[model samples]
Target: MIANPSDVRNLLESHYFLFAFLSSLGTLQIAVTGSGIRALWLTPYRRVTRWLGFVCIITGVLFFFGQPLFVDGPWAAGSVQADSTTRAWGVASWDELAGARNVNDIHGGLDGVDQAIWFSLAAIIAFSVSVVFGALSIKANTKELRVDAKLDDDDIDGLAGLVHRSYFSNLPISVRNFRLEARKFWRDGVRSADRWSLIKIISGGSNQ
Candidate 1:
């Protein structure tokens, strides 16, 4: 069956970002992952990153507009899709998303596949931002790995953040893989930090 993007969009605005942010670590991952810190703004990938960032921001806005629709279908389509309370904010926004439909009695917006388009547009934006940043972070980590030098303490913090960002970038793309890497990053960070802490404690530093 064709997926209903409207439903998906609603989920995103309602609580998905909270999950995404917690699970993925947002933009910090990208900065830490890339050697582009050397020339981040002018890095070869910077141009692409900026555009994707723009798209990500736009997608967030689009989802804002499309939200009520999923919550409230247009009248022409049927009666209140939502309960009485949601009718206030939801119906108006739903009609607006439907694009100048006779919303007086029309509560529902575009029906069937049309309901999916707005959300799909948002998806395009989501993909660009998350994937672009995620990939860049991965490349940076790989580059560091190739060097085989332990990241300095500050760099380790950066790596921790980068791992989180990579987590987010991976969320929508491959949730399973994202979780795996996230576990690795968190566990590794803890182990590394613990080891350092132990050394410092032996040398008279705080034992944790």
Candidate 2:
């Protein structure tokens, strides 16, 4: 399905593109958590959800600095000049660009560093937008634990149910029956604990 894999590789190698991808994921996590929409959350644990967003932010920033942007002038004939910074570093000829374009007869496409740049500024735009959204998401979630508030209902029953169904929906009927039984047992234990705690509180009050 790929028309030009060389272009894809070059795009993927860009620090800006990596930042944008991670930032987008981070934003999505924050948006879902802050929106208090359990249906959209990736996991049942609010702490895990928040941690995922933070992880994304940290990951994006780390990747953004992994490589510096490379710049070269457009070709006029058989050669093009490198950018001022590049030229200052002693690379001024088009031979570097030509060598990059030389395809391998056996494997095909340019070697790792030779792939040409496409959509030069598009990655930057994506990275900037992702950073903005990630910041906004963090701001929105900072006022309150929106994800926790949403999960407070029946201790994240909805979120847990969603995960359980997604993973085991295709399993045999016997497994499904066992899952229901296990859930019932867990709920019974919770209720027993609550009752015992209430009883202890009344006994203590009576003694006082």
Candidate 3:
């Protein structure tokens, strides 16, 4: 339950809190399942997870904006002029309880509605931006992994050479010479048949 809901700030805060909780759950679900969208079972619904994330954000915004309208209406508030029947049941209407205690609070000095509206907009914008970036990252990573998986030994060696040139360009000559000598020594040691066989065994039989 929320305390001081008569204050629109508290009410909006409660709505925002609930939105955060539900959005977190939605994000977690997307994280767990988004990568598997290409799998056999999930391939059919590949776009669904992405759309669901958008829906969660939009729903949260709607809930935030709709609360004020609903709370002010007479049907939602019930009658202040209750008759004998209403009292006979011992049930209190919304007006009998709080009577819209701060009826003008939402429109008054603090700019509470404006603050909540802006906050909800910011939250939605942040969520949308994060989702877009996350999706792009997932796509880039997946493409990179696929390219790496398709690379042969020559391609890998060429990449290693490129890396060595770029990374060691500013190194001292002595340091580069020492690294080359150490690599040569290791390669020479591993060239022995017995040592090579042992290395193959240790490396799960992969000669590379």
Candidate 4:
């Protein structure tokens, strides 16, 4: 992530600043949830928020790592400017330069990285936005349970522990809880589908 002063300055001056800011926000959300500190979360639905964070990180990593395919950098194909038109127009030929850029075109000049950077940058933005949506959509627990009512289980689920205790004591349990919640969500969806099918079948039989 380290860069020269000039690159940093350029990034700040360009739209890339928004990209970087969004990515940083996403990374920060992941850090907060992964560390098991729920106090800072916008909503009380821990499972939904954590899942959103998980998806965000996974997407960001994939897009960032897949830059070689989407990005037409110096190492990309047709980067050497093999012909006069390519050298002059930075495209394969004058026809390509005159025509709209094709979806398959990869020799888009020195600004290739600019075109491709949006994929990863968008992923970064998606990550941050997903968690916020999760927070907004899920309902918070209505009952005001005591923070340390059940220190081991409740404290892990509750927002009582400070940073150190939250990290060391609750992280493992938090991850496990997320897994359980995922399984439950999947099962619930399947069950609902089955019930809908049964209802449809009964209605069809009565109509016949």
Candidate 5:
């Protein structure tokens, strides 16, 4: 059986709707997933992804623009399309088709929309993958910070000489002597009288 012009129009309309739905899905994913990933990366791939999605949406819109399937018109394909150009801007009549047609008669040709689909598809896919990477990146960062904190604690402990690297024959004796001297420094008898009264207390100011 031969395909009626109306049937052909319907088919195009179906395809346009499907593409529109897919384009919307991709755009949504790019936004949600890319934003999720954005929290982790010092740098995000969003600029490129945004540009790509914009291109896809524009391309899909232009492709279905005032075509027989998308607009309200006498043609069979009219009114079947998803008027998706950020504000219903596309071919809505046969006369508009003249402008949509380009180069060898392609509707969504060279002007960015045609080139924008692949970019959009890739960007959306990349963003989906990035969501997982972001979570892993955060977990790894937390673990690293933990390790750093533990190492710092260990270093501080060592500086206080709680752990000795080597044992010299007289080391313990020296350490004991050092401790004794330190304790003596804190004792009242060890501190010289001249060192006292140098600090003026707020309440003692009048007496001074």
Candidate 6:
């Protein structure tokens, strides 16, 4: 695959569109994960955390495969030469080009391929680090929520208010008001004396 530098460059360049597509996919994945996290009453906390972790894994894999084209190095540096060679090869006979060999041919005469390989490895390492940090965050939040469950009503209410404010802090005034109404409904449910209502409210509030 690396027999010719031009061939390697052309192959990588051809994947430019693929790289863009994967990046778009990653962005969509993140947006969906964020939306899921915001719907606290609708989804369980552990499920959200697990889903986020899964999304990160998919994003990381895509990034590892797709980010090399954007990385600054030999891939960008050799573009002009690759383009010229591609045009020249179009006019030249295949046999002539195939027979041509350089005395300095080493490691299949493709230097950029080595750099891309290393960059891909670096991307994987970065992805691994992100997953580790994400997992730790999930663990810490899980522990905190567990502790919060045992707190008194006042403390729990205070914590709930804090969470509500933080979650809606970035929204517009109108949207925030709407979310607050929903919050009130959830709170009222939590305070209900009916057995079924209490169970449902507790499940929703605790999930958040």
Misplaced by over 4 Å in model 3 are 1-8, 16-46, 61-76, 79-103, 106-125, 128-145, 148-208
Q: C-alpha displacement of 200 in model 5, angstroms?
A: 69
Across 1-208, the per-residue lDDT of candidate 6 in tens digits comes to 1225556354444443334333433443354346533222222354554455456556655554444334432223223235333322222232333222221224133255644664465445444443444344434455454465432233223223323222232134435556777898888875553445656676774332
Per-candidate Cα lDDT values, in order, are: 0.42, 0.45, 0.43, 0.44, 0.42, 0.40
lDDT for position 43 in model 5: 22
TM-scores for candidates 1 onward, in order:
0.30, 0.32, 0.29, 0.31, 0.29, 0.24
Q: Report the C-alpha lDDT of model 2 over 1-208, residue by residue, as the tens digit.
A: 2113444235335644456566766666677567554333445545677688779878887654432223321222232233211122212243454433222322233343332232234444544453454344434443444344532333334334322222122123435656787899899987667666866677773332
Q: Ten residues in a row with the worst lDDT in model 4?
A: 97-106
> After superposition on all CA atoms, what RMSD does each candidate show versus the true structure?
12.8, 17.9, 18.4, 14.2, 20.2, 17.5
List candidate 6 segments past 4 Å from native: 1-7, 10-29, 36-130, 147-208
lDDT of 6 at 13: 44
What root-mean-square deviation over C-alphas does model 5 reach? 20.2
Instruction: Write the number of the candidate with greater lDDT, choosing between 2 and 5.
Output: 2
lDDT, model 5, position 134: 39
lDDT of 4 by residue, 55-107 (tens): 65566555433433443322224432333223221223323322222222223
Write down the worst ten-residue block by lDDT for model 5: 161-170
Best by TM-score: 2
Model 3 per-residue lDDT tens digits across residues 39-86: 111112436655666676567666544444455322133432432122
List ranges where model 1 is wrong by over 4 Å: 1-44, 66-208
